[model samples]
Target: MTPIGTQELDRELKKGSAELLILSLIEHRARHGYEISKLIEERSGGVLKFNVASFYPLLYRLEERGMIAGRWVEKAGQRRRRYYKLTAAGKEMLKTQRSTWRDFVHAIQVITEAENA
Candidate 1:
């Protein structure tokens, strides 16, 4: 079997996981784009990083789909930041996505274990 290059692997992982990452992060509380990106990087130990170009579009797409809601929040000293929170639909989506991801991982594990055996 041919081995996947690092770039291809990274791209595939990000494409599959980005929505789940964003939805899971905002599942608990609202977060701005930067915050969400930072959290994903931090939580993943810097394995995953999303630049503004890629990040904002995904956020907007989720918002457009009514999965998430974004509001501009202004603090006394800080500039206005658009924070995103999960909607009821997002919550349901999250549940389904989680199950799907788990099943995917399990299937991969089974295949790899068979290969090893």
Candidate 2:
């Protein structure tokens, strides 16, 4: 098998965590696609970025899976936008994913620390 380069590894890691990131973002309130994208970029300090082609598909997939609910909102003098919020299933999934993520990170940290010792 071909080895994964740094860029490919980064992409894979981002893909693995994308659902968790999205769920956490909308846990409190609903957010439109653009808002979500910008928030992710800003919060990550531009280390992570998602364009329309890649992002919308993930949103659609989550909506289809019942993890998220999206509704169209029309504001005065503005185009209609679909805002997304976490569903009950999403909340449950988020809880589980967060726990798993913490455990995985801790394990990785332990291994790396031991290797450096």
Q: Give the top-scoring candidate (TM-score).
A: 2
TM-score of 2: 0.95
Candidate 2: Cα lDDT at 33: 88
**Model 1 Cα shift for residue 32 (angstroms):** 1.0
RMSD to truth, every model = 1.7, 1.1
Model 1 stretches astray by more than 4 angstroms: 1-3, 115-117
Estimate TM-scores for all models.
0.93, 0.95
Q: Candidate 2: misplaced stretches above 4 Å? A: none
Candidate 1 lDDT by residue in tens digits, 5-82: 999999889989999999999999999999999999999999999878988999999999999999999999998999
Total clashing pairs in model 2: 0
Q: lDDT of model 1 at residue 40?
A: 95
lDDT of 2 by residue, 10-58 (tens): 8998899989999999999999989998999999999889868999999
TM-score of 1: 0.93
